[model samples]
Each structure stands twice: as structure tokens, then as C-alpha cells.
Target: MSDIQLPEDDEEQQLYERETENTPETPLIRRSQSHESIISTLSAPPAYELYPPATTWSGRLLNFFRRIPTRFTQSSIALPTLSDDRADERSISSRFRIPQLELHPRIARWRYPIVGLCVLCITIFSFLLFCSIFFSPASLPSPSVPDKIANDTAKFLTLNIFMRPPGVKNNWSDYKDDRTDFIIRHVLPNYDVVSFQESFGFGSRRKDHLIRAAREMGYNHHVESGRKYPWQIAVDGGLLVLSRFPIKDSRLIEYPRGRHSDWMARKGAIYAQIECKPNSLVHLYTTHAQASYQQITSLWDDDVRTRMNQFSWLHSLIAETSGKDGSAVVLNGDLNVDAAVHKEKSSPTEPSEESSEEYEFMKAVLSGEGKKINGKVEYEDSWKIDLKDAVYESYGFHPVTFGDVKVDEYGMVVPAETVLTDADELMAVQSIDHVLWSPRQSNMNIEGVRVEKFMVADTHLDNDEDEEKGYTQVSDHYGISYVLRL
Candidate 1:
């Protein structure tokens, strides 16, 4: 740096010039240290500095943030130099309000818990609504079809409908709509007479629902097996018949013996005599024999025995009731008797007329092989007969395998897994739901029943919805509709 020469009034300037020019200067007299300090004593006070001594980058940032307000900080230790009322008079623009200022420690602590509670409340409410509507329980309704199917001897439908009693099972999860609405919308509109097994009416309002719905749908003629008043009937023998034509007569017969859960309801048969035409009367036997041989079965041996016993009663009832007349008779129901599908090792893919032990009992009544058991009335299965005929043989039937890949139930194809069993092929491909007819007594060789169209209605292909475990398919069993010409 260059030296600064003070204007020291010639004497100090000449000395500085002489020193810089390399010339010797005269020596000044030395004064005493205390006396010179005292003589030169007083100096001016120092001036204020514009900026503080913060040199490094971090130091500069610390100084800058120290000037900000403390209300914006949860802990102001980072800016300890900042005062409480820093910029108290500054006006914050309304558009730039600070949300962090309003955050409370307590509210922050419970924030997630409160949100979780709200979500839980919504989920519970949704579940309740689902139960009350889709799954809650069960119904019936009006018909749009004519009172009688014209010119046909028998136009009928039979289904199990899986009408389990209210609150007894988890039906709330299995169905997407009320069973009555489903029947009115899907099942009843297509057939003349719809017969349902397991239509229990003991303590619940379902029986009333069906009657009311049926009447509304123009199916004014309907009957129940029996009513115990409040609790008289066992588990509601659950047999019901709804007909478009007038039901001239109706009767109920509860079996004497039922085992296990069968004891819950008096399992039985119900039949009705309908006037199909002026001179031609049709005896419609709508019956549901006992079946304790379900996948969810208990007391297997006892259930089997009980089911057979029930069938015997059913046999006797049909024999006594069915007359050897020219009038037509259709015994249709969830008979729970499949002649070909009993053996665990049987391939379901093969549709053969294979008989199980229980099938013999049913065969005796239907085929008139009961030479010892009165040998009076003989009946015929509509499907087996239809297969032999030319015109109506093309129609299809499907077994409701719950979730298994399906096959035509009318012995059309064999199958793999079904809803009830893990076996690769089902025992047989036919439905427990059966449709049988009594041949014209005039000619023993002529069953006299021609199936124009025999269909397993509301089979898996009928619905657009997936068979979700908790909510799809109104019943485990599909409905059956048969157009018969006798």
C-alpha cells in the first residue's frame, strides 16, 4: 500500500519527505510517558457501525433469520436473538396469511387418530346398509304372463330357492338383493307355476312376503304346507306353490321323522290340483324330500337314513294321491335324489343313468317298480324323456357348481370341480331339482309327455355379476323351467 502523508504544517511534512528521500532528520526531545499521556488525554467517541461483524455464510444467515417474528416458529432457539414483538407493527397481506401460525401442538398430536375415526365410521355405515339391503334377508311379486300357458299340458318351474330361515345363516353376505325382488324380477316372470322348496314360514315374515308378492304378480293362487300359527310347525316345512291357474285343492304332509338339523323344521311335501283347462285337471305335486347329505352336513349316517325314511313317506303319499287317470301329473321338486351322482370316485363328466342306494327308493315310485308297494302309479322324468324325442331335445340344463367350470346338467357333459366337492369330476351332472310326469295310463309304453323346452333357469350364464363369495347369486340352486306337452 502507498503511504499517506498527513498535512502536518511543513515541520511533520518536511520530516516525512526527508525520511522518504533517504535524508537524515533532526531528533526531537523525549517527554515523560505519564505527563505526555495526560497532556494528550481526551479523544472523540467512536461512530456507530452500519453492519455487524458477520463474515461467513452461516453467520450471515443466522443474522438474517434473527430478524424474523417468533410466532412463526415452534421453537425459536435457531433465532434466539429475535425479539417477541419483532415487526409487531408490520401489516401482513391478507393473501399471504401463515397457516403454520395456527397449528396447535395438541391438535397435531391427535390429527391422524381423528382422521382414522372418520374413515372407520364411514366403513361401518356402509356395512350396515349392505346388510339391511343386499344381505339382510329375504321376498315375492306379480306375474306378467297369462293365467295359463296356452295349449300346453304343463308349463312349470321348480327350484330350491335356498330359503333358509332369517338370521339362521349368513345370508346377508351371499345375496346382492332381496330374494323376493330377485324372484319377481328374474324367476316368476318366465313360468306359469313356480314351486319353491325351503320356503320356511314359521316365525319369520318370508311366507307373508311371498304370498303378498305373488298376489301382486297376478299369481293369486298360492298355498303353504301348513302354519303352526306362531311356532307350531317345525322349522317351517317350507313348501310353497304359486300358480297362474286356479289352485282347486292344496294339501301338506310333514314327514314323521327328521334327524339332525332336519329336526329344526318339519320337512314335508305339498301338492295342488290345478284346472289347466275346463275338462283337463292337472295334479301338481310340489314336494321337497329331506336332504341332509349336503356338503355342510352333520350326522351323515343318520341323515342318510332319515332322508330315505322321508322318501318312503313321500313315496306312499304320491302313491295314494296320484290317480290312474288321463289327466296330467307333474311331480317336480328339489328331490335331492340324483340317481347317477353318488359315488365319490364317479367322474362327473360322464352323464350316465347310474343309481345310488337312495335312488332306488325314488325309482320305485317314479318308475312303478314298487310291485310290492301298491304298484299303482307310474311317473317319468321329463329330461330323460326329452332326450329321446326329436323336436325338444336341443334345450339345455346346467348344474349349479357354485364356482366350478360348468357343464350342461341334462347329462350333456362331464365336469371338474363344483361348489360342494373338491373332486376333479362331480359324481353326476344332473340337478337335485327334478321334473317328473306320470305317463298316460291308457298306454304303458307311452309316457305321453313331450318337453318342448326344458331349461335350467337362472343358471350361471343368466347373471352379469360375478359370483362373489359374500354377494352374488340369490340361491345356491338355480331355478328350473319346463314346457311340457302331454
Candidate 2:
């Protein structure tokens, strides 16, 4: 190697001298001067230069080795001459080194750990979901009917009978025949016991009709009771329980007579206790409660209060009797009282004049709203039977409505007419009509105790005539019947 001399007064020397010199000038002037110098230097060719291709093995090796640190020093080695561009290339190469590992194997091995972790997470999530579905209470099964009881009991028959007897002027002679024919034909052949309501006793003719019907049906045990009118002729609107079994004891429970003159025409309940088996007795209660009356009248309030007291008394009496005898009781009747209607909630705001008048009438009869009848004796109205539970046990015992009467459409029953005029009366009628055993006959499991089919027996009643006339033909309500298996 030899020491080389360069030309004097070259562009590079000029640029260096210009950059070193400083002048007291404005910032804009300095920046412009600096920019001009930079452009001139960038355009000028290199003062000393050498060229070498980067593709050579030795060159690449040298470039590769320059990037790594070493413990030994090689200070005696001569430095290679390189152009500014070549030095830039070498500097870039020195910054990064190619890894010695295989590219495919590295990628394959890298994916394994990620894939494994993902699979493990998925499996854990699936296991948790499965456990939640199977072990939760929502997945539990509902109770089914017990197989043991189903296999033992035979299917019992049920029958419903309704009669709208023709008036005495129409056919007085055939009344007994028609009554006897119904028992022998429709009732006795189908059911084990027949329960009757609205059994009119206008004279010996009506009594003879029931007696002959019971005789024809081979029902040796029968009962009938009623109030005697001023004419001394018995107005036979009483309940009768006819059965093949012997009659034990029977009594008519006279409900509180409403002070209203119209209420006197309505009848109270008939309670009976019949011996179905040697050591077992089944109790029967049948009645027709108060009728629907107009509002702003004393009759409407009196009827509601009277009916409420009647139910309270009946419940107390039954509770006492059933408690004492430990007997399975069947309390069925044509209770004209509407449970759904009584339980409705009304707003205090004044309605339209027409609706307000009707509502007032309904409120008078309802007296105390939400006052439930079939409830625990201790808690008053606090404990009432859930309607859904009661209907589930008995299939046929359902709410029936005439005309536009609806029950529980919006969780409350509403009748077409609260007041009963001759034309609107028939359309206004609505009732539960029939309520089966509270706990249901099929659900009873006590030994030597069973309740057979219980239903309303007014399927045959013709409801075509005008309200008053039609109501008088048969009782305004249906009758309840039940058979007990002891």
C-alpha cells in the first residue's frame, strides 16, 4: 500500500470549508445556504472510489462474519477499499444475520404448540357446557302418574243428565213418566249414583215422579226436603241424592235468608251424609246460591253478603264433620256464586255513564272484591286454591259460559250483562257449573278411600226460552254429582 495525495480546491474540500464557516445571519438565509450546499454535495462525484460485486463467496462470507461479535481481535488485517454505496450495502448486511435453522421444520414445530393449546381450551369449554345441560334443575324430569295405582283400579263410568220439565199446563200427566224414563234410560244405566238439584215438588205428582224414578232405577236409598208454601203445597226446589247404597243421615242446611223480598224465592243448600260402605261414609252437599241482581239496590249487597256467610258456614261445618269422621268428603253443588268474577280487580276511576251504572251493580254484588270461598279456614282469603291445579285433576269439570260470558279471558271472568233483564238474563248466565274434588279423585291414595267421577248433570237442559220462563223450567243452575269407592 502507498500513501496517495488528492487534488486541492476540490468540491468535497469546498463543501467541508463552507459547512465549517458560520455567519451571523437570519435563520431563513442560513437554511437556504445549508440546503444549497447539501444539493451540491449530493450531485458531486466521489473523491476516491472502489467497486466490488456482493455475489462473490468471499465477499458474502466477509459480509456475514462482520455482523457477529468475536473474542479474538484482528487488528493487523488491512481494511478493504469500498465506495460509499458499497459501504452502505455492507452496513445493512452487518445489521442482520440469516438463521441456520430449516424454515419448514421451524414453522411446523411452531404450529404444534398453538394447535395443542387451542384443542385443550375447546375440550374444556365443551365439558363445562355438557355438565351445565345435564346436571341443572332445568334438565330434571316432571312427575308422572304412578303405574301401581293405574294397574289396580278399573275405569269407572260417568254420566251427565239435564232436564227442563214442561210446565203443568203443557203436560202434567207425563211429568212422572218422563222423570222415570230419564233415570232408567240415561242415568242408572251409566252412573253408579245420581245427584239431583232443582227437584220441583209442586205437589204429590213431583214427589211421586222422583220416588217412582228411584224405584225403577233400583235405588232403594233416596232423600228429599223442601219448605212448605203458605198454600201448604210444597215447592219442591230441593236437592236429592239417589244411590244404591243405604242412606245414613241427611239434612238441609238453610243459608241466611236475605232481607230482600226477591231473595226469598232462591233456595239454600242441601247437605247429606250417606253410608257408602260398612265403616266408610261419603258426605254430599248441594245448593243453589244467590242470583245476580242490579246495582245501587240493597238486594245486590244482601245477596253477596248472604252467600259469603253461607260459604263460610258451610266450610266450617264440613271441616268439623270431615275432621271428626275422618271421612273422604264430596262437596258438590250448583253454587251460583262465580269464583272468577268475585276475584276481579276494578279501577276506582269513573267509567262511561252506561258502563259505570253496570259496574256499580256488579260492585254491589261483589261487596268485598277478591274474597275467595275455597280457601283454608284459618287464613281467610289469604289462601285460595290455584285454578290451574284444580282443573288438571278433573278433565270434564270445566268452566262453561252461555252467550258472551267469558271466564279468565284476561285472567278474570266477565259476563255479558251484570244486570238481568228478561232479554239479557239468559245471555248473562255464566258459572264454573262444575268443580271436581279439590285434590282430585285420582290423586287420593289412602287405603279404603276413593272418589269416583264427579261432574255437573245438566247436559240435557234446553236453554232456548226467555230468561225467566227458561230459568223456571229447570233450575237456573246445574246440579253436581259424585260417586265414592270405599
Judging by lDDT against the true structure, name the best candidate.
1
Note the Cα lDDT for every prediction shown. Answer: 0.54, 0.41
What are the per-model C-alpha RMSD values against the true structure? 19.2, 31.4
lDDT score for candidate 2 against the true structure: 0.41
Per-residue lDDT over 66-90 for candidate 1, one digit per residue giving the tens place of the 0 to 100 score: 4333334423111112222432332
Off by over 4 Å in 2: 1-184, 231-237, 259-262, 295-300, 340-398, 401-422, 436-486
lDDT of 1 at 405: 31
- Stretches of candidate 1 off by over 4 Å are 1-149, 170-172, 229-233, 294-301, 342-350, 365-368, 371-430, 442-470
lDDT of 1 at 478: 51
